[model samples]
Target: MIRITFPDGSVREYEAGVTGFQIAESISPALARSVVSCGVNGETVELNRPIEADARIALYKFDDEQGKHTFWHTSAHLLAEALQELYPGIQFGFGPAVENGFFYDVLLPNGEMIKEGDFKKIEDKMIELARKNEVVVRQEISKADCLAQFGAAGQTYKCEHIEQDLADGSITTYTQGNFTDLCKGPHLVSTGDIKAIKLTAIAGAFWRGDATKDQMQRLYGISFPKKKMLDEYLLMLEEAKKRDHRKIGKEMELFMFSERVGKGLPIWLPKGTDLRIRLQDMLRKIQKTFGYQEVITPHIGSKNLYVTSGHYAHYGKDSFQPIHTPEEDEEYMLKPMNCPHHCEVFAWKPRSYKDLPFRCAEFGTVYRYEKSGELHGFTRVRSFTQDDAHIFCRQDQVKDEFLRVLSIIQTVFTIFGFGEDQVEFQISLRDPEDKEKYIGSDEVWASAEQAIIDACKEKGIKARCELGEAAFYGPKLDCMVKDAIGRRWQLGTIQVDYNLPERFNLEYTAEDNSKRRPVMIHRAPFGSLERFTAVLIEHTAGHFPLWLAPEQVAILPISEKYNSYALEVANYFDTVGVRATVDNRNEKIGRKIRDNELKRVPYMVIVGEKEAAEGTVAMRQQGGGDQAVMPKEAFAERILGEVAEMLKATNLKPEN
Candidate 1:
């Protein structure tokens, strides 16, 4: 008998070769019936796949994320099977499960194409195949055999991928019914688990995301274990479309992108700029209370800067090319990261151990050469500013600094009205097998990971630990926040780094009067202002909080006579620190209200005959209407009070 340990630390004696399904059957009938997949020592695998030795295991059901991934992965195979039946000689590219659903790229034989109309037919075919209850199968095979099979079938894309990416000893395939594809997978037991299917869209995609490669028809799809879930998802999709930032941003006159200016470069209009600056000021205030010193960094840096930081080796090719000089061979590159420059700042001064936990923050703008096809408005912009900060601390101080950062993040979320349930944390650690992808030794990684885990536990912050998700330098704690529509976004992150200080040869004199390497904590409560703003826009549907709204109030003159009063109200509110604007157009009150409402400004103050004479204005909220007819001073006081409450800091200080 071998010892199998469960996630809760309960161990059981199981016969060797007992499969995950068998183990589940031993525990409970409901678990055996509901479990779709199992994690064996952190590696997800098919439930029926046998275990040869003792391992830690966790069973997953359809409701869990891992279970959804497994379900979708099987659904992708079912899609391939349906397409194989419908379109013979169709060569397949990568087909993988994405966050929302799945997509499979295929080269239709004889220059054939897939269009919108084809979605239904394919979706119907998938449902029919799922009803057949075909048992999905996994097989391990030699790379030589994999290449031979695909080549024989004229699956040129698969053959080329296998030849270039896969090694002989480490390859696997998943087969369901008439379809077989190369995939390293943890698929559901059978196709029958997929009770609902939808082929969302069809697009042209170059194979393997290489723009120069042959273009293939990419079919996007989603599946659910229940039809009701699919219906709910469809409803959310409609709501999401209505709240899409691109459409709302255009309507609100917040931000825009121009093809002539270049793709993936967002131009913040006046309103958007105002909102972003307000956000920056709020963060700065909180940082100041937390004992953070803000700094300024350049938009470009010497190539050697990244070389010393070890980022060039991993990301140089993806960055904009080095800027060449006319005078000599000295080359500079558009800064892809702000951390390296901050590292230089740390290296600028010799410090004693008393100066440990030195924190520096920057609203630093960085650039990346984002492919045009991959860019998506502000969320995936080429140029964006990060609310970045780095804390240089001693080993024992790491947890305290991490908790402080967490508290600051929590305080911000609380101010924005995000509750405990809406925010989740992820402990991202490096992949043990792919050591080359990460820097630092195993000991360093283990220590960093443990530090994060311990900090979260001490703070009672429930976090999901994910393997192979760390930064190249170290492990990180990522904040996964759910927006108003219940869609999860990775909004904030704090990472621990032991590698950078070593790379830069940075040290501080310890109490023993010996030089010691200082540990680094990289943090960004708002990962990028552009992406956060995009999320905020969609989250509130452009109806911003009063304090963060670019124009908190709009003064609408009822007639030509009231324009003077409107300007006076605006100027008075400006003095009281409420951002307001006078709508001096000669439009009627009704028309003005409608236009101002579309702009999503929080409050509208109507200046008419009674209000101008009485030194008061009629106040109306954008969605909530006709609050009160109050004096201009009272309105300004109310607005200013609300702003003060929202911008309140947490006093997030360090614990020595």
Candidate 2:
């Protein structure tokens, strides 16, 4: 018998060679039935794989992330099986689970084509194969044998992948029915578990995401354990289509992309630019209240700057090629990160312990080279500005600074009306054994990591811990927020770093007259203006709050006859700091209201004959309702009052 450790710190005796399924069965039959995968000593693996020694184990149900990944992974194999049956000589490349679904890249035989119309037939065939309940078998094979199997089967793509990527003893193959592919899998027990299947899309993709490689058909799909669940998922997908920022951005005339300028660069229109500025001003006011000093940095830096900061080693290849200067040795790179530049600012002058905590903030625009395929409207743009700040403080001040940053994030979320459930807190730490992946000494990394964890604990914040998810320099406190449609997006982050100061040789004189390195805190409540705007647009469905709306009020005249009165109301609103526009277009009163409503203006005022005569304005809310006629002065006060209250309610006062 060997000792088995469970997550709850309970130990039990189990016979050697007992499978994870058997161990789960010993706990409860229900668990055995629901478990799709198991974590053995921190590694996720197939449930039926035998455990020869004592190990820490956690059984995973379909609701768990690992379990869902396992389920979708098996579904990918199931897709390949269906493809093999329907289209003979179909060669498969990479097939892996994605964020919402799974996709398999494949090269079709000569004269064969797969289109959107073929999705139904393919889904039907997948369901048929799933009903077979075929057991998925995993096998370890030598590289020679692996290449031989795929080569003999005329799966050139598979053969090429194995030849190029797999090592001799590291080859593994998973077989379900007649379909066998090279994979290292923690798959579900059988295809029977996949009850509902969807073939969502078919697109062209290059093998291994290489533009130089042959283009293949990428089939995207998703699966669920129950039909009702699949139905709900499909409904969510439909809702997502409606909220897609690209569609809404164009419809609202917020921003656009151009082939003449560049593919991934976004050009913000007048309305979008105005809205972004409002957001920046709000953040600026909050930062000022918290004693943050604002600064500006250049858009490009010497390649050596990144090299010293260690960003070059990690992101250099993915970044745009360096720009050569008049001198051959002098080269510059588009700023991929702001931290390195901030490091330079810290090093420019000598400092004493009195100047220990330096808080510098910037709305710095940076550039990155994102693959064309990965670029989406504003979310994944190549050029964007980060509401970035770097706090250089003494070691003891790390926790307090971190808590202050978290407070800022909470304040912003509250102002945006995000409830606790709509946002998740996570502490991302480095993998303990992977020293090569991160900078800093073990002691420094440990201290920085613990500071973040301890800070969260002290603040009564419950955060999930993710290992091996840290930045190359430090651990992070990340906020993953869900939009109105319940789609999660990583929005804000605060990272603790002890490495950069050491690399830059930044020093501040201590009371003992000894030089000490200052700890760095990197934070961004709005990671990027463009990406946050995209998320906010989707979350509110373009109905911006009164304070943040680009055009808060639309003054709609009954006709050309009341255009003068409309201008009068607009002027009154302008004096009270209300952003209002007069719609004196050649259109009817009803048509004007309808058109302005689609613009998502928070409020609309109708200055008609009665209002113009009475010196009052009729107020209408964006979605609906006539909110009574009020004096023009009274309407301005109402708008101004509501905005002031919103800011007051959400502002965070720094702790003394």
Instruction: Provide the overall lDDT of each model, using Cα atoms, as 2-decimal numbers.
Output: 0.89, 0.88
lDDT of 1 by residue, 220-255 (tens): 899998899999999999999999999989988989
Per-residue lDDT value at 222 in model 2 = 94
In the range 52-141, model 2's lDDT, one tens digit per residue, is: 998988889988777889999999988989998999988888899777779999888995889989888889999999999999999999
Q: How many backbone clashes does candidate 1 have?
A: 0
Candidate 1, residue 170: CA error in Å? 0.9
**Candidate closest to the true structure, highest lDDT:** 1
TM-scores, all candidates, are 0.97, 0.95
Error of 2 at 520 (Å): 1.8
**Model 1, which residues run further than 4 Å from truth?**
645-656
Q: Candidate 2 overall Cα lDDT vs. reference?
A: 0.88
Off by over 4 Å in 2: 1-13, 52-54, 432-435, 652-656
